[model samples]
Target: MASTEETKTAQVRIQLTTRYPDIELPDDPGPLLVSTGFRRYALSTLVNNLLQTERPVPFEFLINGQFLRTSIDEFLTANGISAETTLTVEYVRALIPPLHVSSYEHDDWISSVDVLSGSSPAVREAEEVSSGQERILSGGYDGLFRMWNMSNEVIATSNAPDEGGHTLAIKSVKFISPQKIASSSMDRTIRVWDYSEESATLTPTLELYGHKSSVDSIAVHSQSSRILSSSSDRSVGLWTTKKSEAPSAPENLIPKARNKRRKLSHPTPSKTGTQRGPLSLLTGHTDVVSSAIFSPTDHTVGYSASWDHTIRTWDLTTSACVDTRTTAHPLLSLAAMNGANLLAAGTSARHITMIDPRASATTIAAMTLRGHTNGVVSLAADPDSPYGLVSGSHDGTCRVWDIRSVRPGVGEVGGGQVGESVYVIPREILKEKGKSKAPVGGEGLKVFGVCWDKHVGIVSVGEDKRVQVNKAGDIIRT
Candidate 1:
């Protein structure tokens, strides 16, 4: 007996195209007989199957110029696509380096999961607590510190004068602990906030004032209870999480020295008024200190960058500069790689330089990364990735870089170098009243701060007066 079995298949026509106008595709591939019950399948599979390529690299898919993230059958029905209707799927290359070294393939770096905007002032600095992903803290030029969550809602904000808030612009913010956060300000003070999750309260607990000028940046120890702050006073100050026992004492200001001086003194009481001073002071730079960050591996070592065009390594315990290297440009930001034996810094000239911590002590930068058209303002190492890093710049963009794939500087022809950006924050058009406004250049959206979470989620605050949350997708290896 001959039994005839019937096969059920759905038909779809795949079209390969790109966003660029000049990118022309080959002839349209014919129909594909796919299973109707298909749930989740790789977009590369469909592209390769239709293109007749033996191997295919990763690419994002769109249906009729609309981006699609689901399986073929589901995407077909949800969009009211019929089996007889040809599915116009377009593909675009993944911009980031195929992360092959990290045992994971990285995606979603080109786009953000959420864009948050409420306040109108540009954010100057921001921080995300790695232990908890919900809370995000940001400082703005409006002299405000705001806290928000994943829902694009402002959780709490410090805009009131009665809450022990800053009377001037907040410069930087860092988490002292999971429950406590500290912020430095242009007002020459650092305010510690006690945040409560259960009651949804974040209020100032105490204030620390030591720097004679505006405090620009701050760093917190990973394994200890210490905090490091840099200031326009051209000095780095070290303090602790403990509040001062005496509140009414005045600052015993240090005498101005002409030569390089590294000294540690007990936190002197403020002479101008009752305030907390730095427990130890590190002075060497001839100009404003832009950034200071603790080594991820060693808590005792701190790195500080300054407008003096030099990066100095500090022995926090001895209050001495162990090493210093002059840079080609004024260094503005820094990030310490935990285990790769490397560190990165952003410069005023729009360059990001990666150096061997052991080798940077005596020589020039090992390699320079070029991408942002404007000065780089912030840098952050991906905590989960072995060689991944992120940078924010005055060009109004955030880019991810992989140390393993950085092009060597052998092609320098004019005593200068050039590099490419892997992924860029896509330019979006503002939509109002059901009509899309003309696209505006990102020059006004200068990124001031960027941070990564334990899950590799990215959050960036920019001069656009916006906060963006970037959540990565599966690591798809080509």
Candidate 2:
């Protein structure tokens, strides 16, 4: 019976393909047959042998839009697929798990994070070569934003409220250029700053006054000089980085919500820079707008995720809400998958929904990614690949996901696929390192923001008031 069963063991046929231009096989190599026991390693070795490369490169394989994590026989059995069918396997460079490198402590809860890589567009345009150094910018609940160097040194700090900085906690921040920074705050204003690295000075350049409620987040298009901000007032503000291009605030402008005045660190006359107004105010969301971002390909189009349980598409050229897609839960964060034509929205329901915002698309959601134990608060698109995405959550972890590895919803009511994360990065506890740093917030370690940089693998900030760096690639040295 054992020998009879062995005789019945099937051989599967596969055809390999890749998007990588340099790494490829013959156009009509024909289908190759292999034993069902082969896994990723065995298949990878086979490809390298065919390429005849001096060095072997690790490869990941995908079949029918999902990664093949199991042996060929096991995968076929689990999916009820037949061994007689020829599989088209797409191979790509395997991504290594990110390693935790360094952490910088802050005074209060860190709300947002961004990175300016050595090879960023702003740096490249200046023709300045960075000696493998990247700058990190962090916004805090302490009503301040700070710039840090690779050595964990504080390079520059924003002024206090009395000295023209935000009077309330900053909610979002971004590096507009090497010399410019932008931040939105609970004070209901967006401030642009002139950063002088040589002098370690951060001076206020412009104060944008338009939103009637606290500004929740801000997105910048440096090349176009445009800024998009989300607010609790249920509107998105569209503004410019240049003051000369902005019009004066309407004289009839009124506050939407009443706020209390708090005692400042120093009571003095306000020095809050030059004031300006938004180019247009986008209103459509019925609930608090948590995030707003420009389209990955088209700057004239924008998307916003809100507590109203809807994701809206806006025509920036006409200041009109063009389309909206409703979801089951409130959305808290959003990011764009460049070249993939998809938007990822982190939801209060503890999962990220992959949305196809195209008008001609029939489905509301293309897929759903799950694994987080708490609300996913923030998301960052991978700079390395269009199919990759990273999310930070209140569950005290950041999850790395590959959109390509998805399957049809097993029990999901929605007519879409579902994906699981490739990796989960947990909050690093200082106590584990023999250091005594107590975490803040009721949950103690919820990640509030996350960003992926070309040079900086992944940067995450949380209720622990720490900016943690996770480095990937063989070239990164801690």
> Which candidate wins on TM-score?
2
Q: What is the C-alpha lDDT profile of model 1 across 298-329, one tens digit per residue?
A: 77889898889888989998999988878778
Angstrom error at residue 99, model 1:
17
The runs of at least 3 residues in candidate 1 whose Cα sits more than 4 Å from the true structure, single-residue gaps closed, are: 1-133, 244-274, 359-362, 411-419, 427-442, 476-478
The digit string of per-residue lDDT tens for model 2 on 1-478 reads 1133452466799998987777777554778998777889999998888888798888889888778887888788778888889999988878888889899999999999999887554453754537656789999999999999989988899999878899899999998888899999998989999988779899998888899899999999888889999999999999998888998755334223323475323322226546789999999999999999999788999999999999999999999999999998999999999878999999998999999999998888889999888889999988877888999998888999998888669777477989999888877775476744333322788999999987877999989899999977684121
Per-model clash counts, in order, read 7, 0
**Which window of 10 residues has the lowest lDDT sum in candidate 2?**
251-260
Question: If candidate 2 were superposed on the true structure by all CA atoms, what would the RMSD be?
Answer: 4.6
List the candidates' TM-scores in order. 0.65, 0.90
Estimate every model's Cα lDDT from 0 to 1: 0.63, 0.86
Clashing pairs in 1: 105-475, 250-269, 250-270, 250-271, 251-269, 251-270, 251-271
